[model samples]
Target chain A: MNSVIHEKYTVAQDDFANAGKASSHIKEHLKEIGVDPQVLRRIAVACYESEINLIIHAYGGDINMDVFDDGSIQLVFKDKGPGIDDIEKAMTPGFSTASEKARSMGFGAGMGLPNIKRVSDEFDIQSSPEGTTITLLFRESK
Target chain B: MKLHELFNELNWDNLTPDVSLDKDVEGVYCGDLLSWVMGNGLPNQVWITVQGHMNIIAVAGLREFSCIVIADNASIEDTVLQKATEEGIPVFASHLPVFESAKLLIEKGV
Candidate 1:
């Protein structure tokens, strides 16, 4: 939570059938709130990556979007799933654990997490056996 | 062709026609996978797939697709339908497989 607007989205897992719904809504809401277009696109892209990660990699999760008084956005996605064993390997550009069906659906490209980090001004990912939490921050003007 | 006309030809719901339906649709691409569609689809191409979700609509929006046809007689959830309305992305449903519908739209020069 921050001084600016905050919205929380509940993400469902393996619900491959309904994934990406929340990310789309959040992006639309950001647009309505007058967020900048380039920043909006970056946010939209990151939101989608993180949201899909929740669906494909975890059982379930929650996304928290925080707008700070500093004209920055913080997107936090937390999921209940098996934690990553090697952060370095996961950070590689082309590594993935996505299922065959997920691959057929056009995901598991190993670009999801990397893209999220690339677009954000600050990105942090912490994983444990219990769950994984990802925090992404984007500066609106920088 | 006006998208609604295409709908009439298919005998399906109005789905989604951009506010500018009079504009001609350039081409079509059909796939349920995100990677292939992103890599292969051209602008203004109609995409037909069995995947029914809001992500489909979002991809259409992100890529500026002409319209999305849901094949295999899949119906869109209300949330996705609402997102379509907001994004001005047309949506459709058909009983044909993705490839078959792609063929149908191609025959129509869609």
Candidate 2:
């Protein structure tokens, strides 16, 4: 089984109105494809968290979700926004660089990245002054 | 308990009339943070919150929560209500606070 399903979504900065549209669509697609319930929940949380990060923190970015036949799911979050200066500090819970607008929306509690990491089986982050890219991977049960 | 019973018991103003009430709520979760709820809210739970933004509907729908009760009489935005109707997720507004709503729901065996 070498089949692969890839979906792409474009995210705009401060686009709170349509922030979770992509994740919602992906959730529906995954449900239609018969993803495990627990796996679906993990993906849903990680995907939405990642999507909001792009909307609130990034200048702009795109989310790529790939589901392979080998029962592995990977979410690639690539952003062209200002790269994180301190990955360690950013990863800390309750540490936030979010703006007032984001805070007002009840997000930016600095739990987005941590929650995403907690939900995914594998997490990788590559950041620079130019941009940031995060990869989250999960394996579906046999 | 059935949504109608719980709604009547708690005096919740049904925000989405087009969506009927027949869900069996098994638990309750109170939180203002969307991500926190997204990661922890269990299915068939009635989510109590003060955040009435449009994205709340997305979170409730994604988690398949039995219903969403916006506490303290917080006004739900029109877009949020419309999406709730479209997604068939029952939503209600409670004049009481989150704690009161949770207490009432618990008494009602939700």
Instruction: Identify the runs in model 1 with alpha carbons over 4 angstroms from their true place.
Output: B1-54, B62-66, B69-87, B91-110
| The candidate that achieves the highest lDDT relative to the unseen native structure | 2
Task: Extract clashing residue pairs from model 1.
Answer: A105-B33, A105-B34, A106-B34, A106-B35, B16-B90, B16-B91
lDDT of 1 by residue, A21-138 (tens): 7777887888888898778767777787788888888888999998888778889999997888887888887788889978766687777777777778888999999999999888
* Chain A superposition TM-score per model: 0.94, 0.95
lDDT of 1 by residue, B4-93 (tens): 566567754556544445444778887766644643456677788877765687677755578888888876788877878877887877
Q: Give residue A72's error in model 1 in angstroms.
A: 0.6
Q: How many residue pairs clash in each candidate?
A: 6, 0
Model 2 residue A44 CA deviation in Å? 0.3
The interface RMSD value for candidate 1 stands at: 3.4
- For the predicted complex of model 2, DockQ is 0.73
**lDDT tens digits by residue: candidate 2, A1-142:** 4539998999999899887889999999999989998889888889999999999989979999888788888889999969999999998877899899788888887888888889899999999978999998888752
TM-score quality measure for candidate 2: 0.95
Q: Positional deviation of A109 in candidate 2, in angstroms? A: 1.5
